[model samples]
Target: MLNVLSVLIGLFALLFMIPAFLPFLGIANWLLVPVALFGALIGMLSTRNSGRNFCLLVAAFGALRLFLGGGIF
Candidate 1:
């Protein structure tokens, strides 16, 4: 159940970051970072894993955005 939720949150983050593909949506794609991080934290607290998979997923998503050159930094 918790694992499922974590995956869902990760997926949603991926979706939210997709807006970067639209020209007018420039800068807006940055917002997905926080939204995804929030979801990841929620999923992390709800999960029973020893390792922080949620945090890792969030990092990966952020990195993906960064690698795509869509980061605010």
Candidate 2:
């Protein structure tokens, strides 16, 4: 269950982050709000082990985003 939740949140975060990569994309910052909220919600719903894994997923994504130069996935 927690792994599923982590996947969901990771997917959503990638979805939300992907738009930032577009050169013409506008308002990319807005997506972060819901992405973060959903991530937090997932975290809240997750157990300790799952929550830590989920956070790691988030961090991996953050690193990816950084590598992408702050662009969407």
Q: What is the TM-score of each candidate against the true structure?
A: 0.52, 0.46
lDDT of 1: 0.59
| Candidate 2 lDDT by residue in tens digits, 1-73 | 8647756776666676566545544245345545645665666666645654554566555555545554433
RMSD of each: 4.0, 4.8
Candidate 1 lDDT by residue in tens digits, 1-73 = 6556666766676676566545555455466666666666666776464223654565566666565664543
- RMSD in Å for model 1: 4.0
Off by over 4 Å in 2: 49-73
Give the top-scoring candidate (TM-score): 1
Worst 10 residues of 1 by lDDT: 47-56
